[model samples]
Target: MKNYRLERLSSQPIIQTADVQPFIEGYDVLGAFNPAACQFGDEILLLLRVAEAPKAEKGYIAIPIIEEQDGVPTLVVKKFKEPDGDYDPRVVTIDGKVYLTSISYLRIARSRDGVNFTIDAKPFLFPTRMDESYGVEDARITYLDGKYWITYTAVSEHGPGVGLAVTTDFVSVERVGMVLPPPNKDVALFPEKINGNYVLLHRPMVSDIGKPSVWLAESEDGIHWGNHRFLFGGRGLVDTKFEWEGGKIGAGPEPILTDEGWLVCYHGADPTHAYSLALALLDKNDPSIILDRSEAPLLTPELPWEREGFFPNVVFSNGWVRRPDGTIWVYYGAADSGVGLAKLIQE
Candidate 1:
């Protein structure tokens, strides 16, 4: 058991699948969670990752895909016969090709009091390019250069990669295309430039040589990223007593600049793929240096909603906002089905 605890703000999920409408016809929402949070004027905006799947038929499996024709994008469904391989609620493997049972896109939910949210009927961001043929999911919003820079995962036939979009007002968004190549995600940009260079925390999926862990990168311009450095490792390389993060770890929300240093909330998983959130502090001047890190999880799967759902035993976050009172409001996806809120209060 851990010593520190995060205060659960709501007993139930703040956002669920039932609260959202599918962007495409003949589709059902599977989950509405993993929101990127920020403040716009007097309202708190949550860029929600809404996953939807086509209704099932008797003998065919339907896969949702985005195809462009005549310079226009359209959502199409492709049906396939069950093939030889493993099948799950999330994905199906047909020979060497993998298809997601559900497709995801970003939507905006606005809340004035931070609890009650009114979601936009249409998706805030959806698949438009071939690179995002599979889906676009898990966004992190950072306000910099007088605009809100949104970094998210763009999945396609190639693989999952990092993509960028920007908005001055939430009404109109401009897609900046892919910032990082395939097999990289969980990116969070610093609120401002660090030492005259843009800094971001990203995770590159590794299997053969290195473990999946957090890395630091600097860009002269936000679009071109280079000079990658290993900041920290996951379970096999940390000082934590338990194997809570023995699987992999990734950067969460934008790092909070504190008097002591940069406070970051990152998510980790065990060998079982159970996800949890923890804290890490980095040098204010040089974020590549680790100041301190939590030995135990700050938030984990405990509540029933968090322990069971579309994907069980998960409490993943990509967004958080700091209040005037110094408490941080963390908005996370519970069990990959619903959105929940928690708080980190200064002791």
Candidate 2:
């Protein structure tokens, strides 16, 4: 098989935080990225993960959190004095617990030409349940069985987990609850059922023994998944040396079935957490079998916007769309701050 090259769109950073407003009055929109894309009729829809944080006051760091207030979920800010322990640009360790600098929710944006977009006024999905109190992020959408199934990360004190939701018109959504428990995320469902069972790709993190790697699973109802099989491992599992995607790697968009095999685009991070996009081909019938993979990354952080922002040196994708002419449009998050587009022609 020939290697596929990513052709970036000239009009990059299709969406940015500056183009969006905060959902609440006192908060600020930090990022609008990692969108899940799909063709809806004549237009394309992007389910964006919009990150927001309350305006921090001087000498005090603040984190936005959602909590149940009289049975209604309410957004609030928890402020803390200058941390005596440790703090970073994205997180702060106050006392013994670590908190994110911002909170994320799902928002919908639509475009006619797939470049310019109109983000909705309010959040499309937010932290309603306690499990999602921290945020809901990095959504992957797959149209299967006559419905658009969304699998996203539900973040809270327990860590990131896979959450499911479905919608027919992108208007009314049905929450399908948490399908995969904590310490697992980056879930992407296959576009179709294989051998009468639903299939998906996910990343399960490891801390003690094994390394964080991609895995495959099948479900009879698309909800109760089982038959977990390790698909592949990355670079920096047990070795002391560092390489590309050695820190961790996760599944990106939903696997696209092609003449060659199931094309999968995923992100790999070095020890520094600098992310890049790579490709892999899985066996058509049994996705657990690896057919081929890219030796080098197809997409990396290079652009000014991609190399700087909330999280620097990152290019992460959770969605893409295949055009009728066989062109694949990859929508990715740039520095965890904006959205960028890249094109690829599978030859």
Candidate 3:
């Protein structure tokens, strides 16, 4: 049987708390969760995952988010228990010290060695008047047809959704608005158009929606997406108690068009939220159709550091890079703590 290896790429996190302070809060700093790395004009850019805690008052909960005015990326101090309160995660105090229960927002940074990074002066993509009232998280970037397409999570009091944004120079962002409806996240777009149409993989979570399974969706102009169908659902296994998806799974990075098929890296979590990375070979002509998938995990939380952190037992990804020679570089978040990488072998 062929086995997939999870080798350590970098010891230092690409986007760490030490570097991302003052611009954002540290109490709940966990950037680079779904970092999107790509080579542009001779340099590699990493889209980091940045989270912040709500500022605390005497007894009020100061929610931290990207203010929705001028889109300049600022913090707001709001009471926690508002009638239309946020619903991404909860931030409640236990005894005395404050903690970040749920901090959601989009953070960006650039890198040279794919390890050392410099955060933007301000947030690259923040909350707007759209579904981001709750917050933004997990961005997957793809460069296609002379433009960059960004697929991200739009969180609100209602639920989590997917949003799209386009850019050319990577400095000025043109928001295409929320593409996916509600209760959906972890979207990965095919690096290029499939059959003259945009192909994307997304997962919509519903307690009654037959578990958090992966789904397929297609777009025409890369903005509005629809025509949902099942790409692949979790299977019942002897070791996994014959259960489908534990919690969720979706495409990790932009799909790489390979000789065999499109190499898709995704994440699968059980009911415990312990995430592990996996692979699924997709048909190049029609990526929505799954060709083959791994029965076992390609990369799981086996290390001490990966087994413990803000959220223990987690190894999630949203981006990767594939060289011309078929060499692959995958970057992921460790226990929702920092960014890590591994190699992809398709021999």
lDDT of 1 by residue, 115-194 (tens): 89999999999989999999999999999999999999999988899999999999999999999999999999999999
Candidate 1 residue 212 Cα shift, in angstroms, is 0.6
For candidate 2, write residues 1-347 as lDDT tens digits: 25688889855698988999898788899999999999999889999999988887988898888788899878788888876655585777778887888999999999989888999999888888888989999999999999999999999888999999999998889999999999899999999999889999999878878878999999999999999999987866555443777878889999999887899999889988899998999999888889998777788899999999988999999999987677999999999899999997554
lDDT of 3 by residue, 58-162 (tens): 545565544566765455654544324453344444344333444565666676665567777677876765468657788998988898898888876557888
Clashes within 3 Å, all models in order: 0, 0, 2
How large an RMSD does model 1 have?
1.9
- Which runs of model 2 end up more than 4 angstroms from their true locations? 84-86, 236-242
TM-score list, all predictions: 0.96, 0.96, 0.85
TM-score of candidate 1 against the unseen true structure? 0.96
Q: TM-score rank, highest first? A: 1, 2, 3
lDDT of 1 at 166: 96
Q: What overall lDDT, based on C-alpha atoms, would model 1 receive against the true structure? A: 0.90
lDDT score for candidate 3 against the true structure: 0.71
Best by lDDT: 1
RMSD in Å for all candidates: 1.9, 1.8, 4.7
Please state the error at residue 113 of candidate 2 in Å: 0.8
Candidate 3 or 1, higher TM-score: 1
Query: Clashing residue pairs, candidate 3?
Result: 31-49, 32-49
